[model samples]
Target: MKKTISREALKSASLEYNDVSGDFNWIKKRRGPIKVGQKAGSINHAGYVVIKIDQMKFMAHVLVWFLKTGEWPTLDIDHINGIKTDNRFQNLRHVTRSVNLQNQRKAHPNNHTGLIGVNKKGPKRFLALIQIDGIQKSVGTFENAIDAHNAYIEAKRKGHPGNTL
Candidate 1:
């Protein structure tokens, strides 16, 4: 609800949002580097689209929610399909922190396995684990990394099959 740009101001400023394509565009020329009809926003470090106006920056998803609903949201926005830059209205949802974490598609920074939820338990053993209801629980150990990964996926499926690392 804070730092809100009114819908009218948004239309006069950023111009339009293509709901189907999830793309925003400038309708009129601006004073600086932006040109009319140019695409708005750029991918930030964490892979989300960011838009800047009047020296203030906004997350495109947040803006989309605000523009679509005419009210700012107070909860985390989860990209249902796990694609950070896909801002399609249908692909976004408001969820609690735990639900948002459930849909996370990236491995933790400390996770060394190329596959998420699997880790090397020892020199030759691979361990599979998953987070359920916010608690991390072990699935099983395997001699092959792929098996460990599969075990993790199966464990994850038992919880929420729509999302996997």
Candidate 2:
């Protein structure tokens, strides 16, 4: 199993965090292509930044949270703008897993309507659905997808964990 990393360990390591820009710079040279003062992370397969320290891989956003606050996050870190690689301190929020999922910037790939929670109900109506406390609640039918989406956003504003609206 991989060992759990601590904030103090990262603070003493070779990385220097740039909170405003969300960039990590190498503070010292290391073996095999790593150089002093170079950017210290790469875009991972999921589009988030990942950096390797002492053979252990860590998400750059997590590192930023750790370094900036001096406390490892106990919950999910959300990128408010939906760009996973953008880890600027102001863009990051420490939230619950539900809130993290709710703040997504894009509709699901399988969503045919191109708007989150809005689906075609019939020939001239749309359905709006939202998740609240693990329940999929229907908001109501609407004439257009935008209206349905607005209903969903309104429901989210009420109490949905994401509250990104």
Candidate 3:
């Protein structure tokens, strides 16, 4: 059977080392090199010597650590807000590769139909399209970029169930 350690037990247990700092405390043995845990190779929480904290799985915890500690993470934490670093739990959302691509912003100049809308055979006019769940959906065509973007947003809201679009 799998063994589960209670939070109280973990709290009372002696912590030999703190990954945040190089110092070691507790126990009679002098400070020495800490042995890496069995789950050390796992990404997200690999650096910490204690409990595993998977930022991808538990984004709220990641935001809490950042907000309370003011430590910037090395990895890119994208918020579903279209704003890359909002980090608010309500605004934060887990996204797959395709879904993330669907939410990407428009590319720079010279890149037509890269975002905002899809270009037709004609010039200036564009069709707003959003791909969700591997299905391509055309929102509608418009004369202006903003109109196309708005259409895309509306379509996104419709496509994603229970999504705070």
Give a tens-digit lDDT track for model 2, residues 1-165: 534578767877788888767899999888889889999889988899998877788998888887778777888988888889888999888998878887765688999899988999898899999877778889999999999998888888786645665
RMSD of 1: 2.1
Question: Which of 1 and 2 is ahead in lDDT?
Answer: 2
Q: Pick the candidate with the highest TM-score.
A: 1
The 10 consecutive residues of candidate 1 with the worst lDDT sum are 156-165
Provide the clashing-pair count of each candidate structure: 0, 0, 0
By TM-score, is 1 or 2 better? 1
Per-residue error (Å), model 1, residue 122:
2.4
Any runs in candidate 1 off by more than 4 Å, and if so which? 160-165
What is the C-alpha lDDT profile of model 1 across 1-165, one tens digit per residue?
Answer: 468777787767745899898888888787789888898989999899999877778899988888888877888887888888888999888877766777766678888887788899898999998878668899999998889988887788788644534
Off by over 4 Å in 3: 1-78, 88-102, 107-110, 113-115, 162-165
The better-scoring model by TM-score among 1 and 3 is 1
Arrange candidates, best lDDT first.
2, 1, 3
How far does residue 27 in candidate 2 sit from its true spot (Å)? 2.7
The digit string of per-residue lDDT tens for model 3 on 96-154 reads 54454555565546657565545543577877777777778788878877688788778
> Lowest-lDDT window of 10 residues in candidate 3?
48-57
Q: Estimate each model's TM-score.
A: 0.88, 0.86, 0.41
